[model samples]
Target: MTDPNAPVTVTPADDMPASSAKAVQALALKHLYIAWVRFQRRPESMRSFIGYDLLYFPPPYAAKWAKPFGYIRQAASTIAAIRRHKPDVLWFQSPPTFFAHLLVAYRALGGRRLKVVADCHNMGLDPDVPGNFWMKIPGTIPALNSFDVVIAHNAAVGAKAAGLGVRSDRLLVLETRPAPLPVDETAGDPVPQVILVPCSYHDDEPIEMLMEVAARVPDATFKLTGNLARAQSKNYPARAPANVQFTGYLSAEAYTHLLTNCSLVIGLTTGEGIQLSGANEAVGAGRPMVLSDTQLLRSLFGDAALFAANETAPMAAAVQDALSRQGELRQASRTLKDKRERRWRLQAEACLERLVP
Candidate 1:
């Protein structure tokens, strides 16, 4: 247990255990740390935690398996990070996969002083990506108990985490935040040929339904982003139709450009504990949204979004309706700006509150 009397410090790292490769860590060292360097230059320094410009120390050689070797090496770096910074609370975002188990092992083996808060960002059951029993304890859901608090982005995910043994009080529900995306109120006019769908192509996304929707709404083209691999098609057994274009990975400028100019942004996700980044982007840019009927999106978007059942015919109808009610939907999207603008601050403040005096 962390010492209550000790100096409270909080820090967030892109610490997804499963995917934290040396190459990925290098990006954090360069991009994330470099951004911190720039932020500190302005003098109104963030008060919660004192961290080095560089966040992660990836191991030199990549190992092939998960066990005492790969697991212990990753845990050691995280342990070392805690000891060096001596944070009362360390906020690790996502993948209860390895890190959560690591923390449990750390505490049982040696670590006890730092409080671990697992920010279960986009955390869900993820039936598609089965955990390897060969990896010793499968996925990260079992690691929820180690954390003092389990932060979930949506209530559906929070409930899932609760089912995994995280106490109710320990579960904090933070909404999908509004990003610093470019906005264009009068976008997608005259040449409204695009309907943007932002997805990671996970199993949770119903690609067959998307294909059917595309065929139904032939007037507007569907542009899907997220650089998601087409191999995910193996999950649905349905290929994307002709009108649907996959631009794959997009740069920040390109993403903003696309979102700003797109006619309708569709959040056609099929599960919970996920984000509609594309829908959020559409809202920011004052573009109408056709969202999947999930409690989370409904709560955030309210009447602003055109709610569609996660099916072919209904979703297609919703898309058509959005096209017809473009003016009203645009107004609704603009109204969301007030809500979206405050999200980043609210999320930041909520996290900061955990790192108290």
Candidate 2:
């Protein structure tokens, strides 16, 4: 007889039917590759033992290029992995529109013991975005509800998901916090007059407005760096203003180097609820920041960074403000670094509690 208080073990049964092997294994499906790196850095409780799918599926970069059958092939392999390994829990990342349909169908209809989870990164993803036909299916919402849990980055984002008919009880908020700085507090002095603008350029970001702001502040060069900037290079309004430069997607070393050495960092966005990833990198590097004015950014940054309305004029003013008050902004960066050090681990722990069973 199985002891209720005893430990559980998964013994390989190769000779057993393939289906039966899954009955013994406890795994975590990592189809949402982007979430893997974040979760990997968390307390081991949130760590998953297994992973599947491409290791490099950054949004719009690969997903946008993938043909329908390509997605089908990707989903097929992931499903096969889950059915074979039969993970105790499967965690998916943002835009949760991928592979979830099949898994929900299988879990609802099949007697699989898997408990599925979808973690939303608040990259300003909306299931209702037009032309995203997959999200419109009648079954999609129901399928998402069928998952054991849906972890949102914040309450506002959770509300967005809930509006799509998902139960509030199924949606949990895991506040996103800044990552720890890569360098020590006493690293080399920052470069003078170089403002680094880090962006993923998710839809609705004011890239052109930033360029205009760059044009207005020709004295301080605005370095736009990321995949989004590179992807939109062909459509850039004009030869970038004399002071604006795009550095393409950066290597970690390059990104860290730039973030650590910049005079200021700019992370502008349109989502009122979304937290920008660049904000975390800025706080970690102890660099002053200029973020678009939004309740979410304001709460996270408090007095640590400058805020600007999405308008070109206000954004330009914010940059000029940061430039004028470099001393105060530098102090704010120190304060933010301290706060991030104190709060990030706690925040990460809390998020994991909701994420893992």
Candidate 3:
């Protein structure tokens, strides 16, 4: 197994045909991926899609007062890591879009020929921070436009970047599709179970609506995964149905087991033009899913997942529907996974051609 910390050096696959010489050449390009996120699926998945040396800087939890200091420490470490790696291409995630800006300035001032790519999440594009003037002034637009390429999750998001002055030619729409997860066939709940994976009590997640939906479906157990204390502080529903269980936070292995063995997974969000990571996890596990009804989701998922509005009644109904048709939905999910993987390959290859050429 390739070490995640080591510099990326592509070795031609044993089974790779000679005709794939161009692919081998592209994969051989040196790459270093940097991210300052606590958890993300895109960087992890990118390792398999395209080779990269992942320098993941998971910032330690800090109080609001100490957050700035935390960024300072992480920034120092990131600079050292990049200088040591000295890669041909530098790809990084943008939520604190400052990271992208920092790299752009670094490349300019240090006189390095490094090509920068910004993988902008939805929040990275539009920070949605209420009344934050900094987000509006000299925000993501300038930082994004500075990159050699900017990756968006979908065309809708790409359009947003284009509207904000990021050149269309530099934008690539690359969805995050996780690698297939190992299922624990022996692990399962005695009662019918539904797993709700939220992206940390974001405003888009309708926690109260889900709680009500759980109350409606008492026969099925509902397990919510995340930091429960954070959820509570965010004013998420304090009281839940007897069937509802807060799983605090789960380890990666435990989380995968829960998703793979669950009767259904529900990924609900009120945000427009944003894809839920939880839904991707459900797809990775080939588990049935009930996702929020939105054009972006419908277009991406097609018939693989059940759609429901964020309202309580519709969501409850969808959950019940998914539980009943678990087998059919599971098959559909597998089919969707195959289709998405093919699509991702074509897009990734096109991206590599540009980067490697």
Candidate 4:
């Protein structure tokens, strides 16, 4: 219905419909301006048309042997980039880490006018976790308090933030949204695989539980993907489970192939963090999931996912249940996919309207 060569029309803030709020307009303008600045600095970064100018600061060191200064340098570069871009809202993907503190310092110095939003990806409640130590300390708690808004991925995380003395009103729960599943018409041969396990080197992830489950279900084949650390990959539990097969990290195309063909996805992590991105991707691809029953996980997936209590025998039982009821779970997975997509779109729209109006 439209001409391909015609210029795209964007309504001006003043001329926008009355339904749009002034706050939304201001927010949108701020983000657009920031996006423009980012484009000027590195044009390639603008490929994704998401409204906010997101600057992700990856952790500094992978191993204990690495010097701390290298991480500090990376943090400094991130801060410098933010300063140059001068975004209206500075959204930190996962705060309470060392790199996040660097960002906090940058915001404190001269970026006071910036509307800072700290997006908490993990539950910082447990004292044993590395980030929790900083979160618990008196000085560190107030440091995080400076942000205008604290965005929690799930209700459990929001509660944790509140317990840490974060203002209840400022804590917004924004769950992670799965990317649209790729359509593959080829329809590869079905392997009848019951479980998919995506593993990383992180200790918090319940890899041991997965191994236990794989051992328990002799008839089921477990496909493990994602890069494992040298030690983890080398010494992976091999003797007990002939059904377990490690395929390392798959390319997007290959991963999609597996997702399209797999019966169920499973993860057993102890940390109160919400389901990892892979879990959302699996659900989006219409794969039933058996995840840990942490507060964050329960909040995000609700009853849509089969949950195990405290990362042990119950987790294996949940996985078995998902495997047994694959048909119903598959239908539930599709419903969840639809619900999550709608929620994500609404949240994104709200965020965009707030920034761009």
- Can you write out model 3's per-residue Cα lDDT over 22-139, one digit (the tens) per residue? 6556677778888886555677666754667777676665466787888888888788887888878888887777887677677778646787878878877654422223345465
Q: How many collisions per candidate?
A: 2, 1, 0, 7
Ten contiguous residues minimizing lDDT sum, candidate 4: 35-44
Give one digit per residue, the lDDT tens place, for model 4 in 1-357.
332112222233322223335444544443422111111111111113234444434335557577466566556666566666766766554434444466566656765467666656563433444334545544544655665656666666667667877776566666667545653334432456556776654667666667787777777888887654542655774543788877875654676677767878876566765457667766667777888777767766764788787545777678778777877777777788788866764554444443332
State every prediction's TM-score relative to the real structure.
0.67, 0.73, 0.89, 0.72
Candidate 1 segments whose C-alpha is farther than 4 A from its true place? 1-89, 106-115, 122-142, 186-192, 231-238, 272-275, 340-348
- Top-lDDT candidate index: 3
Candidate 1 achieves a global lDDT of 0.59
| Segments of candidate 4 deviating more than 4 angstroms | 1-27, 30-50, 53-61, 111-113, 123-138, 183-189, 192-194, 200-204, 225-227, 230-240, 246-261, 271-273, 294-296, 309-321, 324-327, 345-357
Full-model lDDT, candidate 3: 0.74
For candidate 1, lDDT tens digit of each residue in 270-328?
A: 66545565666676678888889987788778759989788888899999988888778
Pairs of residues clashing in candidate 4 = 24-357, 25-357, 26-357, 27-355, 27-356, 28-355, 28-356
Q: Quick one: ranking by lDDT, best first?
A: 3, 2, 1, 4
Q: Which pairs clash in the backbone of model 3? A: none
Clashing pairs in 1: 96-140, 97-140
lDDT for each residue of candidate 2 in 1-357, tens digit (9 for 90 to 100): 322112123222212212322322322222222232211222111222122222322232245556565556555555565565555566666444655666766666764665666666553235543233546545666766777667676667678878877777677665544544454556443545899987655465778788889889988878887665444754663556888877776665676788778888898877677677678777766777899999978988876999989999999998988888766776777787777645544543443344344
Best model number under TM-score: 3
